[model samples]
Target chain A: MSENTTASTSPGVPVEDPTPFGWLTTADHKRTGRLFIISSLAFLIMGVVLDLLVRLDLTSATKFVSLDADSFAQSFALSRETLVLLFLIPAFLGLAMYLVPLQIGASNLAFPRAATASFWIWKISAVVLIGAYLGNGGPYGGWANGVDLHLLALSGLVIALLLGAVTVATTVMTLRSPGLYMDKTPPFTWSALVTASMLVVSLPVLLGQIAILYIDHRYGRVFLLGNYGIWERIDWIHRTPQLFIYVVPVLGVAAEIVLAAAKRRVFEPLAMYFTIGLVGLFGFGAWTNFAITGEGADIIDGLEGVVLVALYAGALIATAGLLGLLGLAVIQNRKLPKISTSLLAAFAAGKLVLTGALVGLVGAAADWLEIAGRGNDGNPQLRMTTWVTGQQSVLIYGAGLLGLLAAIHWWAPKIWGRQLNELLGLLNFLVIGAGALLAFVGPALSGLLTEQPDFVYADPNATSLYSNWVDDTGAEGLSALGVAGTALLLAGAALLILNLFISICLKKGTEATEDPWSAQSPEWLLPSPPPIGETDELPMLTSGTPLLDAQEENEEANT
Target chain B: MSDITPTLASGRPQRPRTQLVATGFASAVCAMMMAGALGFYMARRHASGPHPGSDWLDGLAVPNPQFDYALLTLVASLVTAHWALWASRRRDTAHAWTAIATTIVLGLGFINMVMYSMNRMGLEIGSGEYQNLAFATTGLALAIVVLGLLYIGLMGLRSLGGSVGQRGSTSLGAAVFFWDFAALVWAVTWYTVYVVK
Candidate 1:
């Protein structure tokens, strides 16, 4: 047993880790969620490590590292892939699994055993995916069994994620307390519903693409797609519009954190839901195909193209709307809200999401203009350039990871019944925020200085990701700037891993009081880290802010 | 805080619709996957510039008619699935058993015919774009059908234990929904790849 096992939770109760067998087989949503959270964070370290390698490799134009271009290709592909698939997406999914039911006044997900199965499959498949990379078989590897394993493992991961999404979505749709209809559920729960729905629709498209990639690769017939630019085709999951799905949760999560910190009721909760849903609506990136649409296809030249461009712009507006509403609530607080790391992280998350959206908007508009035959040139050629990487970093690193940090801080007491070291959380946020900006701005500026394609071919002449592009400045400093940004991101990720270790294992921080933040959601009604909240009786919720309503009732009773 | 804790637990649980909702959501996922795959198929076919015929599977023998038979068998399974749902709801235990067994056989028959069609086509994997897609699209459809079969089989076993005798069993409805979804997708695929060539 470790020190965390003997940690204090409630006033007299002790928090203990479940027995090994119990943890593995348990259908308890919270336990399953814990498994997801810990594993994904572990994956986060690997992703950042690979990124550091890529950074070092890219520090110069003519190969900074001794390894071949193929090795760096694998590094580039795995770095982005692991961050999104292995870390951010699963981490947020775990958050939903752990908190959605509790927020909606339920005990477990709609299908508890299936949820357990999903998590295990995800964990095993994640191992296989990483193992595939380790065994010389990721994106640009030799035609080996490891490559097939990567495809099959990816197929399994998609299935697991879809199953998990169904569980969360079903729970939200069916298991909410009787009086709490969809509209009346809390912001986080609503966001989970929207997020799960988006995943259900968008992820299947990826599965569809993967099916072709897998079958082709497995059979050794790359006739349809001979080159191992497989990552280029499927990497749309990390692209502009689709990548926003991961950030949609940030908008919803920020609402919950702001409400609790402000101690003020959201005057327009429905508006909040609409904006959240709108962001999710555009995040349905199943329609955008990088290979076809990015090449100035007919889809971009017509009315469909205009509508799609408008939708990308719409996503940015929704992010702005969400930030404005949240800002007002905070500014209007009766007294100054407690200045905690969680609150600060929430603010920073908003700014990052907005920044990411702005970058995405620029990319979309430029592509639209060029395809519509009204552009001077594809200036700053966002596709296949570091410009796209900049947008991805700001979104995935800034919004997704930072928002997750904020949520963990806000809900740590409720999750583990102990507070994280607040000082460490603040440092984590600042370091990561600075890293996100540098990662975005450096590459973005570099894109303007000269043409540095993010995905470089090993042969260098076998294939070109961008068909129409002329060298702008042809300079050398762009690579170094990108390297600097990558270094900062790696540093920030390392600090996060250490902070989590100390908080979860070593510190055994102060026990969390019930209603730690005067939270309005149903989760706050339970004892901090209660075993299965659905078992607890709760007053019938008439609105999103159930706790606030209950407080008024209590005041009336006392009077 | 102590006084409010009591009222917090006062809310009562409602009838859960999880089973049906989950099945419905799963069905939606299957539908989207098929749609996306078919879209990919069409895009690839068009990209390859082989518009010699309407159906992309132009090289295969038309008189073989194996895909036609496979699609028919899957549609037939949907009817039997609906019958089982109806019987289970009416508490006709014997008809429910018969209907479920018939549905299972049809589901198995559909899978057999699909594999048999693949065999009859004699298309080896890794051959080219057409052959690879032929296996993948059909294989994915077969997997969805197998998933429905498992759900139907599970619900059928529940009927023997009399839990499914309860009126409005969502499990039965869900199984039927999944089967119906499987058949619907197969029909669309049948038209796209097997018909109109």
Candidate 2:
């Protein structure tokens, strides 16, 4: 409960007495960090399991479960939506929300009790969401009024979000330790603060929309229906504001890694600011693209599409700016040694493989789009073909999957104080990467096959997802590759989970360690097992590495 | 830079005086938040087409009187936050506890009002878009206020008279201006463009 404002610690400062029922009553950031990681991984497992079910249903070309076509459709889409909304986003925030402020010198979150309460709210909401599956007509039906269950789920979601947002906002606004001002704050912290602001502003609007959705479901609320053009409003929420929630946080993490790894500050402050602004603005524009392209009297299908395309172009520019920063860092820091270990496998190998797969698929899609000559007018067949074959499998499964694996490996030591076996980790990365790359090729081949005349004997009643792909030989090959990827992915995922289990089982004597990455930072300078209160001494910052600076100072004093 | 060194020998840093100021500002904000929520609830009750026999020809019906109960709750929350700040500033242990006890009462008032408003609205998410905006934003704003009050209350437990509640109140007060202004602008524009138009 004591205030610890200084960044430095006094030597051998006494650790504060643990609070009564400390572990149970504790709201300490580090404990919260561990909980966040575990909870997110749990959600990830659930999402992956659902994904496996989806893939299995597609692979077998029959309803594995005794559900109608509509039910199947509803289940699949909802599963995809939930995977992102219910699982990934929440889980990612679990760590980021807890860790960012602490890393940036915040004493505690702005509102600690709210932080604890939000966790409960989120858990309850998750339960209600799962419970919605058992009710009247499942949680949602595609393009229909059966949205009440979802609305109910959202009520819980809004409560949770409000709690999470308030806690995070206050932490950012009030809890920063003395000397860490707006500018002096770490880069990661800056990105987090920006993201937190976005969340505070944007989440309420989303909650408002969810409220409307509840009405539409429960009481003939025609907000999104033909009457109010509610769908357009909902789409508005989706395109711009929604993108920031995901992108900004990822940018924050990337910025931290880039700056620390490159040993350089951000290239230009204005560029970072401009990039955040553009993303926020263009994020809104992208929603118009979600509008139905064909003529429904209410649809505003005119220049909105053109505007969306142009906005997407802006997104590319921001991405380029980030890449430019990365490139500049490379050129400037040729002397800094590249550190490698089994942990780097996911970052290095997974990325390389995922990149190669993206290239191949993109090339195939470009070729198909040109051949079909439906360049501006979106050809549904061509679009669906490309989606099922490549982007869906690659981006969703490859980049997302591998990136998470890498993050887990990188953060494990710091969080758990245990090292992953380097050989096993590298093997897991390779298996996952190979599986993803092979999976990408399957789609392009399906597209090529679709163009050929000799394609027949594919099942007629085999649903849009299956029938679309079966028509293309390239798609068929892609599906085959998908089968392999699925096997490999499952094996890899299982192996990773098994490794976690093994680590848990094999605990060593308690000791804390800092700078698990062997990197240079103030955090790393602390004693291996630092005191809980964080000692009252500050390292004199000569170089970026504080431990080295301290060692040098000691040597000079001795001389 | 000279202020970096602590004069207090107790090892606890001094509380920045602005914390008391922030408590004042946050209390006012919370009052507005409660008032807005009450207004929204009333507007909806009025809009639900005149309570049974209580009709007037001009069609300007006042909303649910139950909203007063909610407003009272919000006021209670504000007072608690204010007292926490006041007690901490004066180093008054007894009043700080009293303030905390009052905040809990206010928190209960808040919950009661939310439930009552939900019941009266009958789940149309507050009658219309403007009402909906009013209720949702007010709800979030109230939640923030409640948390702020609770934080101040908690700050009391850590202080045996060394100075725990210092730094960042003025900044927070500054932040509330932007936050409140943004909400007002967003709501006003939304009403003008979509609801009223």
Which candidate wins on lDDT?
Answer: 1
- In the range B48-118, model 2's lDDT, one tens digit per residue, is 43457753222322234555566556555555656655665565667766765676666666666656665
Write one digit per residue (lDDT tens) for candidate 2, span A9-128: 444432333554443344555544455556656665665565555544444332343344455444554455455556545555565564654454434455455565666677777666
Instruction: State every prediction's TM-score relative to the real structure.
Output: 0.91, 0.65
Query: Candidate 1: how many backbone clashes?
Result: 7
Tell me the spans in candidate 1 whose CA falls farther than 4 Å from its real position: A1-17, A220-222, A227-229, A291-305, A367-380, A457-478, A532-539, A552-559, B1-14, B52-58
Per-model B-chain TM-score: 0.86, 0.46
Tens digits of per-residue lDDT for model 1, A290-405: 53222332234355556657777888899888888887887788688888888888888878888887777766666554421223343334444667777888888888878988
Pairs of residues clashing in candidate 1: A107-A534, A537-B8, A537-B9, A538-B8, A538-B9, A539-B8, B55-B197
The candidate that achieves the highest DockQ relative to the unseen native structure: 1
Off by over 4 Å in 2: A1-24, A59-71, A134-137, A141-149, A181-184, A221-244, A251-302, A335-400, A435-476, A508-512, A527-559, B1-197
